[model samples]
Target: MKHLILCCLLLCACVAAHAHKPSDSYLNLVVEGQSVTGQWDIALRDLDFAIGLDANGDAAITWGEVRARQSEIDAYAMARLQLQAGGKSCPAAVTEHLIDDHTDGAYVVLRFRALCADTVSELQARYALFFDIDPQHKGLLQLMYQGQSSTAIFSPDKATQQFKLTQPSRIRQFVDYGREGVWHIWIGFDHILFLLALLLPAVVVRREQTWQAVDAFKPALWSVLKIVTAFTLAHSITLTLATLGVISLPSRWVESTIAASVVVAALNNIYPLFRERRWVMAFLFGLIHGFGFASVLTDLGLPKSALVLALVGFNLGVETGQMAIVAVFLPLAFYLRRTTLYRRAILLGGSILIAILAAGWLVERVFDMKFLPF
Candidate 1:
């Protein structure tokens, strides 16, 4: 039974490690009278999959290559996106094309203008980019109308949406971003595992190189409080800085370091290092984890008016999700602290599996390869 449960847990860890990836596009549209002008930034990697971008098969796409295929790129993107005003289709006319760098990778930027037949009131957008190729693809929209900006995320189910040409609602924006924050934490398997690895040892004390359950709950609760507080403070600082464009780091480095942190945290469970100072580990690693969270928020491209509210809502939502996980885990761990299942099966076996999974993530992120299917 123990071996069977261990195998099942390891399998889950493997699947979750691959569930996260970089797949998003930015769309900013401005409405003026009976016209629409906008910029669409699509990932070159996705374009390469749809239509070949690497001309010579040299594994590198150049400006010359992308420039040469400007017409094709425009046709492909415009066809996928349908803009309508007053219930009439407004075909896009590609004005200019360029390449830009985002946190994830290189993107092809298409600037275009759309002229509508009637006065603009209810603007509709139907985005289907990369849906057939990658269902995980998300089209993030920043719409500006009547001097007010609004944000929306487009997925397969919610692809077609209509925006009103009026002032944006702060309440809607806060709720939307808050839900996204909670969803991100749930899908962030590496972050969850790292926190779990740190928490697994919280209810126990180290004695002669072995872990033993604590008699009083106060000590364990205090330990968790300190660790959680440190992690929250550290990540909050970095997340704010990165989102506000104060500091930036390469996506590859941030992702690889996050995976490495998970490995180190899990390994520290088996081999004691900095014993009882796990809060230090949480604070240091939580800093890098902030960058991971910033990627999603930055990609949304929130306007100045809504930035502070969105950031606060998103951060609170993340903390709510984190507390939910702790609420379920801490009680069960405390109850089973004296059992062999908690020590051998959960702590040792689970930590080993998490370490293996994190090492796989490190390899994939560093080499930019897809070794697992999520």
Candidate 2:
């Protein structure tokens, strides 16, 4: 019991740590012969953390403060990025500095130009932004060369990458997007909580107003299959539609509803709603979750040449990630289904905690306020 309590606490801490969207910076670079032009959109919150942006310390950062610190910002940012063209270093300079708003928050946009010694047939970029302080920070890159677009992600482990100025590789794009899909689902706390909330009862049966462990593993496995399949199918539909721009919804509305879904799903675990047909619930909410997933791909901007492949690869990767979570959870949960630790502590207590955390997220997202640090 004591060990179960510790594990639950650790889980809650992990969730809270990643409750908000992970830090990401958008880097769009265009290569034209020996010249390079691009824009880097970095979250102001992240910038403030790296360097003191608030001059007056009133918690509000003004243009005056930002403008005054432009040189520092440029120096700090440029030092982290290096570019090369045709085996020679291409020196970059900040041509413009502006601010823009994203779905999450405001960002500092740095527009820059670089000149190379020779024509750029290939481009090499080394991105180390924010990796020192935050290992989870990712640099989302969109590279354009000779009217062809290619995309890549820069992480702490994979900081430097080279791109050919000719055509993009279909296999590379598929694998990259697939890897990103897995990463996104892993970091997406609301999605994970919603799925877990549904899975918590998969190993047990509701009978006579009480829960009982399943007599055999087959029933539990079947229950998980139905729920996972329903969620996969529903989310795949919306993910495709939303990514293709056939359907759209306001980001705030989508995000708020996603949080609300987590709240409802967690509460249902405690209050006993949709006892036998939780898959139906999974399908309905998964449609909304798909929209949430679309936001990441939409921001990444699919490669025009390999659109279908990238989409399919990413969707398959999501399923792989989701199933990986289930693989670890289902067997252990089944093993402990008959224990008080599983029923009362994990199912009831964990659900209550999830509900409360999600409720906080709902209020924060809807009100556009930050009540929690995450």
Candidate 3:
């Protein structure tokens, strides 16, 4: 019992910490012969935190402020990124500075050119942006060489990476995207909460206006299987379509709807709608969640040559992560299904808390404002 309580507390802490999307920057490099040209998009919010983008303390950043600090921004970013070709350094210089808007917020765009000492067959890069302050920061890199595209993600643990410009590895791309899919699902708090909301009542059935624990675990496991299957099928459809550019939706709409789905799922647990057919709800809302997942892949820019392999790997990774969550949750929930603490506190109280938090997310995403501290 004490362990469960501690676990719940730790979960709440993680939810608070990740209430907002973690920081990420996009980098695209084009390699031709001995020349390298690239663009880096760094979030202004991150830069402001790192090097005071806002000249005044008004809590608002403007183009004037950004232009005034352009030199400092260039220096800060350039110092963190290094490029090398064929075991020789390729010194780079900023060609242009601009601003752009991403789904998250405004970003500073740096366009640069690097001249290699020899014809480039292999390229190496070292990226350390925001790693000192925000360890979770990631650099999404897209490399284009000889009409072929490859992608890689840079993290604090793996900040420096080498790429073979001659031919990108299909196996490496599959593994990288698969790993990213698992990481995204694990950190995706809203998705986790939505799944938990559906699972909360699986071990119990409502009878005579009250909840009663099931006599055996088989029924609960079956219920979970249905819900998970429904969600998996629904999201996989949209994730593939959206990533393939067959369908597209605005990021704001997708994010707001996803939050709304979480709210509805959690509220249904407290209100007991669709009690016997929860899989239906999962299927319906899981479509919207798929779009949310697509945003990550779309940003990564899939390689056209090995697109299917990468997609399959990522989808499998998502399923693996989802099943792991179920493995941990189902046994613990079944063990305590008949307990008053599980019935009252975990199911009811936890649902209420999830609903409230998701409601906050819905409002913030819809209004384009930040009300929560995170």
Compared with the true structure, what per-residue lDDT tens digits does model 1 show for residues 1-374? 65545434433533455535457899999999999999999989789989999999886789999999999999899999999988899988999888998876789999999999988998999999999988867888999887788998888888999888888889888987886677677678888888888988998999988999999888989999988998899899999999999999988899999999999999999998968999999999999999999987888887788899999878887888888777777776787788787788788888898898888888988998766654
lDDT (Cα, 0-100) at 125 in candidate 1 = 94
Poorest lDDT segment (10 consecutive residues) of candidate 3: 9-18
**TM-score, one value per model:** 0.84, 0.95, 0.95
* Residue 131, model 1: Cα distance from true site in angstroms: 3.1
> Local distance difference test, per candidate?
0.85, 0.88, 0.88
User: RMSD (Cα, Å) of candidate 1?
Assistant: 3.3
- TM-score computed on alpha carbons, candidate 1: 0.84
Q: What does candidate 2's lDDT look like per residue over 115-135, in tens digits?
A: 999999888999999999999
- Winner by TM-score: 2
Better of 1 and 3 by lDDT: 3
Look at candidate 2 and give me any clashing residue pairs.
Answer: none
lDDT of 3 by residue, 1-374 (tens): 67577447424623553553568899999999899999999999899999998788887899999999999999999999999987899999999999998877899999999999998988999999999999988999999998999999999999999988877888888998998888778778888888988998999999988778999999999999999999999999999999898999999999999889988988887788898899999999999989988887777778899989889888888888899889888888888888887788788888888888899899999998876866
